[model samples]
Target chain A: MTAALIWIFLPFTAAIGLWAWSRHPAQSTRLATLLCLFLATTAWLIPIGKVLRLGPLTLEIQPILLLAGRRLNLTDTDRPLLIFFFTIAAFWFAGAQQAGSHRLFIPYGLAIVSFLVAAMAVEPLLYSALMIEIAVLLSVPLLFPPGERSVGPGLLRYLIFQTLAMPFILLAGWALDGVQANPTDTNLIALASLFLSLGFAFWLAIFPFYTWVPLLAGETHPYAVGFLYLLLSTTSLLLGVEFINAYGWLRNAPQLYLFLRWMGAIMVITAGIWSAFQHNVGRLFGYALIIETGFSLLAISLNSRLGVEIFTMLFLPRVIGFGLWALSSSILLQAGRSMEFQQLERVAEKWPFASTGLIVACLSLAGLPLLAHFPVRLVLLEQVARQSPLLAVWVLGGNIGFLMSTFRLLAVVTGGYFGPRQPGERPLQITLLSIGALSLVIIGLLPRLFLPMFTGLLSAFTRLP
Target chain B: MTLANLLLLPLLLVTISTLIILISQNWRYSVLALALQYVGVFWLINGLWPLGLAVVKLVAGWMACAVLSASQPAADVREEQTSPTAPAFRLLAAALALALVVSVEPSVEARIPVNRFILMGGLLLISVGWLHLGITTRPIRVIIGLLTVLSGFEILYAAVETSILIAGLQAAVTLGLALVGAYLIAAPTMEETP
Candidate 1:
């Protein structure tokens, strides 16, 4: 049996089965959590391409799976990626119970996992673009659950942007088909770079293409959008890394690095400026995510071992940051409070845990000291300063913008003045909120605690500088 | 019809129908024109695959139109809703798209193995479709624009690379787009706010 069958197909079949068995949101959440946890644990414990003796039987998982004239190669190199994705899935699935997403979230999320892994695994790698597009097609239903009478323009825009990206990336792949033999084909490289940049920009929601992020955040359920953003960005970033891994010219191009850094800075600076002036917390959700994307790009642009290390370090903190934001904001939303400044008056008095979680999450996203995102942001900034002092200032300016937004958000949640206090937070919610916030603070103070888990994944991109 | 004319017929149909869809005041005619455009796309795909496989493209397009038509308000009364822009805007857009397709086709053909008719038709659809997307606030209209663009992409990609996986994916995308479009049309409160 192929390892792809075990890791990819098995989960896919089970996801569908679970969906068929029950559409109850709570039941689906629990089942999905268990399934994702199981998948994640198995990925960590079971090494592929190794024979194991089980009582009288011998079991081994082969590395390749051939389906419909395509190959899915699950090599030892892919082990870390699988573990990373499944672990990420487990984290979100575990949150589903608290967030109360629809029943289809797990099933659709599982199927999305299969499709994304297939995109990575599929040979004749151009097919990955199609695979990714299929994932986009499925996301429509997931994002706009067939509820009654309405769908958001944000989801449509999201779909359109993602769809627009596919043709460009595929076209780039087609253009770069024989680039290895003709490395000096400057025209080909230019065309491919243009196509690739546009594709990644749409995928990453950089600069002008980022308007949909805030719209979707305000429109969709916060928890669903959070999961959607994390999965989409993580997968696209991996694919972006794969692009660099495949092409020596793209990797070595001094101009490309400069472009990435410039674009990253722009994303940061813009997100910062916009986030600061935002009156709605839902809108802040989008800006915080864009800030994370900008930071990730900046980390990649550093083009150093430490840069890659920082990139890896950025992951766990991001998961925590986005999770805290999604869960807290969702809790507040369920309590029938709008995220708008006027509506949010005295909300903190009613739901302290939810309010506190939202603030800490935003603060962490802003890279505040003693928050989860601070350590990685600090390392990345130090690297940037060594490269250029002026750019470092701009980068600092961006974070300060986010910090201002968080301050505004804190004030809004806390109120212009402390109003009438209620019977504080539910114990379960307070406990969860405390754990999430404490982790951020603790991880910031001692970065080593969570930094080790990421080191192994960094080695996967061995080709990166 | 001669083979040469058969080759030209669908392209002509596609161009005429898309132009009408772009400039027309009535939504019903626009939907019908989109279906006609898909038929043109299917003929273009015929050059790349077996007749059986090519039929999927036509089926998907027609099905999409059907779904859109179903969601549309009943057509007993006559009400024509023109675009906010002058008809001159479409003409200008078409001319620009024509310039783009004419300029880009030779290079596109050189890089990718596809039928010239398909390439030109698809390129035209893609170019005009992008214009349509950019100008519209209407969700259903935007979806039609997306279908137009994807029809172009599917024709080009199916020619360059032929496999069951991509074929299935293409069909699924078409079906999904139609579903989303239907959902949008039925949406009680339109979100053209963005």
Candidate 2:
């Protein structure tokens, strides 16, 4: 058996099966969640290229699955990525039932995750662009589920921007071939870099290209959109690092990291400034996501080992914050609230657990003290400060702007209500929110303990540093 | 006819088809223009790839059109109207895009070696398709625009890369985009979510 078969193909098969069974939403989601958990556990436990002995029968999982002149290779180093994608998939699928998402959510979610893994594992990583496009296409129905009356411009723009990236990356790959043959060709280098930059910019939704983020969030189910953005950004960021790591010229180019620093700072400040003025919690969450992405870029742009570590460390808090925020937002949405600050006034009185979840998620993302994002964000800013204090100040200004919005959200939700307080959230949702809120605090208080677990993620990019 | 003349026909075909798709308000004509554009794409690709491989683009493109035509709701047919001046403005934009392509074709060719006709056709479709995307908000039109843009890229890319896996995957993406377009069109008619 190959690692690709187990991790990539198996989940894909299960996704197909789940699609057929999706009419039974409850059973399908339960099975999907369990399946993803099992995959996650296997990814965590079983080492690829190692033998497993089952009472006189020994089996080895190979790294490569050869298919029609191409390969989907997942080595021992790929275990962490498998675990990361599947664990998040499990987390999201587990909440599908309570979120009142589309019935196809679990099935399509599994398929999308499988495609993303395929994007990573596929040989000649340029194919990853096409795989990502497929994932984007699969997400369309999830975002605009069949029967929904309005087709938001956000989804359409998302589709167009992502689709446009494929040709650029593919063309970039072709140019890189020329550079590989003649590494000193400056024109080739310039061409390859331009196409690659444009490709990733579209994928990452960098500024001037990020208008769709808020629009999609405002229109779609918060839970599903959250999952899509989280998965896309994580994969895109890693893909980008992989590209830099694979090419010596790219890694050595001083201008690349310089560009990243400016772009990262711009995304941070712009998203933060926009978030401060936003009325819709959904849109605010979108801006928060953009800020998180911006910080991730800043971490990588630091171009030091410490910066890379901070980048890797940021993932845990990001997932926690977005997950909690999405769950809270979904709960409020299913309750028929519009997610506007005006509509959310006194919401804490009705659904205290969800309200608190939303508040904590936002504050944590804003890098509040003793919150999940604070330590890494603090280090990231300090490194930026050492590089250029003015850049650090700009990053800080952005964070402060987002923090102001979070405080405003807190005020909106916590305002006066005369009625006797009664919990509107279901017990299961309450339990989930409580767990998520506590996780944010726990991870925040002891980041060193929890964050180190994800260090293995960098081991795959051996050449990056 | 000389090989150059043979190639020029398909080039002209794609240019005219894309222009028609851009200017036509009728979905039927737009769809027809798209199918013809794929035929032009196939003709251009056949120069580089085996006839068998080139046929995939044609078949997939036609199937994409079929899916889109079948799935478009009646409401969309009624609502696909545009201002009387929009097409005229689009036609002017197409002419400008063509002028830009003609002026820049040599430099682009220098950057990545390909035939002049293929380059011109690819650039024209890409430019017009991009303009189509910018001007339209409807899902069907957006998909058509994206398909046009991709079709342009594929024509140029076929001259450079010839991996069968990429070919198959690209075809799959074309069909997948079509299916998504259909889904977006039909989404409103389904029963409301619980």
Candidate 3:
């Protein structure tokens, strides 16, 4: 058995099967959650290319699966990636039904996860662009859903920017090949770098291109958008890290890291400032994610072992914060049928768990003390401060803007005349939100225990500092 | 036809079809133009890729056109109504795109070994396609614009890469884009949000 077959193709087939069963969303959710958890467990336990003894039967799972003259390779190092992807998949899927996500979400979400895994597993990683494009297309239905009256410009723009990124990345791959052939060719190197930057900028939705993030967030179900952003952001960030690790020139270029630092700071500042003015909780969710992405970029900008470690560590808090935010916002949106701050009066008094979840998520994203993002954000900002105190202040200014928005939300949710509460939030939702909020604080307080686990992620990028 | 004129045929087809797609409001006409544009793409790619592989682009493009065409009659009611000046505006935009393509062609050509006609055709389609996106908020038009952009990139990339895997994956992406476009058009008509 090949590791690629087990980790990539098997789940893809299961996703297709699950689509047939998506008519029963609850059952499909359960099945998908179990399948993803099982996959994650296998990734954690099994070693690719190593002998395994099952009683009298001995077996070795190969790393490569060949299809139509191409390869899907998953080595022992890749097991960490598999574990991460499937674990995140399980996390999202487990909460999907409770969040009132669309019925098709379970099946299509699994398909997206499978495609992203294929993107990671594919040889000549440039092909991941096409894989990501397929995933983006799959996400359209999730965003638009059925019976939606009128399509939003945000969704269309999301599709456009993502699709546009594909060609530039593919073309960049070809140029990099040229660079490989003629290492000292300055022109080829410059062209390749430009293409890669533009491609990733669109994919990651850096500053100017990020207009779609808030738009899509405002229009779609928060649960689906959360899943979409979480998977896309994580995959793109890993892919960017892989590029740096693979290319000596990219890693060695001080300009690339400098560009990353400035862009990271810029994204954080812009997203944070925008968040401060937003009255919509859903839009706030989008801005919060943008700030997280900005911090991730800053982490990479540090260009050291600590930087890479912080980058990976950021994911745990992000997943919990975003997950809680998406779930709580979804529950609240379903209750009120609107995400506008003015419309959701006394929401905290009405549904305390969901409201607290929202507040905790925003605070965590703002890097509040004793929240999930604090320790890593502290170290990253310290490193950035050491390099350039001015950039660190700008980043802090962005965080302050975001914190203002969070405070605004806190005020809105806490005040307003009390109305009769209707049996509060669902039990499952309360359980999930409570667990998620607790995890954030726990991770923040005991950073050493949870943060080191992400260090395993750095194993996949051995060449990085 | 002389060899020079024959080689230029694809570029002419591509330029005209891209302009037609940009200017035409009729979904049918735009779809037809898109198919013709793909024919031009296939022809340009034939010079670089094997005939068998080049056919994949035509087939995928035609399939995408078919998917999009099948989705339109119900969505016809929602199509944007353009002013009389809109077509002229689009033409002016196309003209600007052509100028940009002409100016950048030399620099682009310098960095890689590519046919001059092919390079011009690719750049023109991408430029016009982006113009199409800039002008339209409608899902179908944006998708067509994206397809055009991808087709343009494919023509240039065909010169640099020849892996069947890339070709197949690109074809799949084309079909996926079309399917998603069709879904967006038909989404409002479904019974409930799924």
Candidate 4:
């Protein structure tokens, strides 16, 4: 536990120390890159159940830590979550070095990681609002590059929507507290359950509240967008799990779960349609996130341990896939000096490796068969069918929309034969694409290997009773 | 007053101030109204010290407000110096304020859910300020609106009783945001003849 605490805090401390030393940009970048690598490595090395002992006390570093007044727990279920965050942190750092944005990226990346860890460590019922706020604030620097155009309006909008969602979550938490005080308080529990689900819907950026994601994506660098999306989706899903785990009464609220299912289905379909029409590469990434989040919501609305397991497994591939996509896009934007689809279209053949990676990532994201997303999609579909056949149709439509959008980009990237191709090839680009494509195929073929780990993680929540 | 009342009263005051700013036709009152709101927030933080970790926050809020006020431009130099107050602004503010106050004071017989009420009010005020800033073309007005929203959020965050680490991060992020806002306003892209 102490080691985990130290591991999370070290980068955060380094971020501050590096910021104060920002006059020496090179030194700051070097120090931050080291910290990022250190954090990523430590996250992978830590055993799932290893508890750290300090003198007279022993603290377990699992998902749940029951302190005197607050609970700081990380269950087996959270293993994938921690891995997702740290892995992204690591990749963002590496990509920043390659893209020459390390000075800004490192500090924001560390702060983001610290905020995510803090979000995960705190009990969701009590601290969801604070978690969202921290995530929002951490994103500001990343969204608006230093000395770039002001992201004031965009940042403010993000803050407002997130803050607006907080009251519902806090109120729901308060209601849950009331129910805990008296288990017979069905009325309070029901209201709390409804509010909590709705609050999560907003927080997760479903439909109407999702405007901010695209705006931020359009304005910010791809790496920043990836980081923000990862944090929001993963943490929001975990918060949903925590809510269900903490409130047993919520399990019986079939109507609320049904609402969530339909909501998720609508989000999936709408996001898919939205992605189909987007011209900007950044907006495409934003819509893709919305679609992915829709799948996660579908998994959660299944309201079973199986649903939880699938949701947890979803994060691993996404972290790798999105990281690659963001890196590729960042490279393309830098090389082309614009994020416009027209500029990107011209260089598609020139940057063949990056273009390939982007295409593969889009396919994986769309849940095409024989890719990383297939297994999870199959499970989610089965669960949705079990709930309602109409839901299955909705999920299918969403899947098709996602595929169509990916194909749209793939078409452009393969070349419309309209512009001259640039010269020069980088080995690292090829390596990244190959690794991404290889992992997608490997995971698609052997889904069971990943299933057990996520299942074990989900089982911890059921043990709460 | 009971410990609960101590918490509830200041929150009520903040909510009322939010309503005043929201409903007032005179945009000039917003800064004063927001500052007054923070003063109420200061009182709540002082009263709720026994909740643990709030003492540090109370002191921090005081220092922040002191520095901000000292550096802030005088009202005479504000962008709205010659603008006429609009009835539409007053109506919108009034409606929002009324809704917020009504919601905070639930019909049920209980001390208003202090923590939750304050949080809700803070969110509402900030969102309003955000909208005002986003829609306005004037740079100075936009900056003031953004600052108002941020300060409103800062007040609500003070009540969270976060760890020292989280608090420090929050402060740093806030400062960074301010610097970014200032830079944007100063940039040539933002300049226009008013």
lDDT of 1 by residue, B116-166 (tens): 787898888898888888877677777888898888887777766667777
- Number of backbone clashes in candidate 4: 12
Model 2 Cα displacement at A314 (Å)? 0.3
Ranking under lDDT, best-scoring first?
Answer: 2, 3, 1, 4
Write candidate 4's Cα lDDT for A1-465 as tens digits.
543465456667877787678656666766766766666565555555677567988766454455445565555545545655666676656566544453556676677677667676775445646656666656655666556644444455565566556656766666777788888866676667767866776788876778877776776788777877787777777777767776667766677577778777888888887777777778788888887888887887887777777777887678777877887787787675466666766466677767777888888888888888888888889878977888798778877887887887777666676345653346765676678678877888887776455554454366432
| Poorly placed runs, candidate 4 (over 4 Å) | A20-81, A100-102, A123-125, A418-425, A445-456, B1-29, B42-87, B108-194
True contacts kept of 1: 0.27
Off by over 4 Å in 2: A417-419, B1-5, B74-78
Docking class of 2: high
Q: What stretches of model 3 exceed 4 Å from their correct place?
A: A416-423, B1-5, B74-78
Residue-wise C-alpha lDDT for candidate 2, range B1-194, written one tens digit per residue:
53334789899899999999888887888898999999999988887788889899999999999999998655555445668898889999989999999998999899757678888888888999999999899888999999999998998899898888899999999999999988888888876775
What docking grade applies to model 4?
A: incorrect
For model 4, residues B144-184, the per-residue Cα lDDT tens digits are 45555655555555554445544554455445444444444
Model 1, A131-247: lDDT tens per residue?
A: 787777767656776553566678778888988888888777866775776888777778788889998888888878999999889888888889889988988887888788778
Candidates in descending DockQ order: 3, 2, 1, 4
- Predicted model with the maximum DockQ: 3
Q: Score candidate 2 by lDDT.
A: 0.90
